[model samples]
Target: MANSPSSKKRARQAERRTEVNKARRSRIRTFLRKVEEAITGGDQAAAAEALKSAQPEVMRGVTKGVLHKNTASRKISRLSSRVKAMGA
Candidate 1:
């Protein structure tokens, strides 16, 4: 389908980028899931710690364009709030 040399190169590059982005997104989700499990298990301290580590990873995703800034911020906000509620 990509007959021109430049187009062919672009297609290859796109494939590589897709794989990288998929891995990055999956990694971010794993961090988020850890926080969620900690919260759901009612371990406030663990949830707090998990959120501490996950926040930066989520933000890193935003910086890398894997997620939007607002989405990352909302996720961090919701997770922290849940952690706080667990404390109370």
Candidate 2:
């Protein structure tokens, strides 16, 4: 219960931020899933393209504070490696 007016305002702000962050996280997951589906489906070109599109969305998540920088980098690295391996 937020008794103070300022605290109530903060609570409202937090609720809004939580919804926004949740949507951002879901969007990032969707992008990652697209890449994974492409990779698993054995479409190298589609996988490469999906990875290309996902990289920016993942980085955007990091920039927006929904994901850590290292986490985003690691994900990008692993996906790119898998995409590359598909070519070989």
Candidate 3:
């Protein structure tokens, strides 16, 4: 489908990028799942720790272009709020 040499190179680059992004997304989801499990288990300390660990990972996703800044922020906000509410 890529006729031009530059277009072929660009297509190859996109394929590589897609693979990397897919791996990053899976890793981010794993971190988020840990946080969710901790929250669901009602362990405030563990949830706090999980949140602390996950926050950076989520932010890194934004920085690395796997996720939008606002999207990551919103997820962090919601997860933190849920963790906080677990105290009640």
Candidate 4:
């Protein structure tokens, strides 16, 4: 469908971006999952450490445009709260 030269170039760029973004999203999810598993496992110390490590990864996802700022904030907030509650 992209007949023009610029359109073709754009299509190619989009394809590459999609691949990169997919990997970024997967990486972020992996970090989040680790935090979740630690929390659910009732290991307060491990959950706290996991969340501490994942926090920057989530923020990096925001900076790299893989995640929205507000979305990352909400996730971090909720995860921290759950981790905190685990201590109580």
lDDT of 1 by residue, 36-73 (tens): 99988989999999999999999999988999999999
Over the full model, what C-alpha lDDT does candidate 4 score relative to the true structure?
0.97
How far is each candidate from the true structure, as Cα RMSD in Å?
Answer: 0.6, 0.5, 0.8, 0.5
lDDT of 3: 0.96
The residue-level lDDT of candidate 4 at 26 comes to 97
Compared with the true structure, what per-residue lDDT tens digits does model 2 show for residues 1-88? 9999999999999999999999999999999999999999999999999999999999999989999999999999999999999989
Better of 1 and 2 by TM-score: 2
Q: What do the candidate models score in CA lDDT, each in turn?
A: 0.94, 0.97, 0.96, 0.97
Q: What's the residue-level lDDT of 1 in candidate 3? A: 98
The parts of candidate 2 lying over 4 Å away from their true place are none
> Candidates' TM-scores?
0.97, 0.98, 0.96, 0.98
Q: Please write out the lDDT profile of model 3 over residues 14-73, one tens digit for every residue.
A: 999999999999999999999999998989999999999999999999999999999999
Predicted candidate 4 versus true structure: per-residue lDDT over 7-84, tens digit per residue: 999999999999999999999999999999999899999999999999999999999999999999999999999999
Give the RMSD in angstroms, all C-alphas superposed, for model 4: 0.5
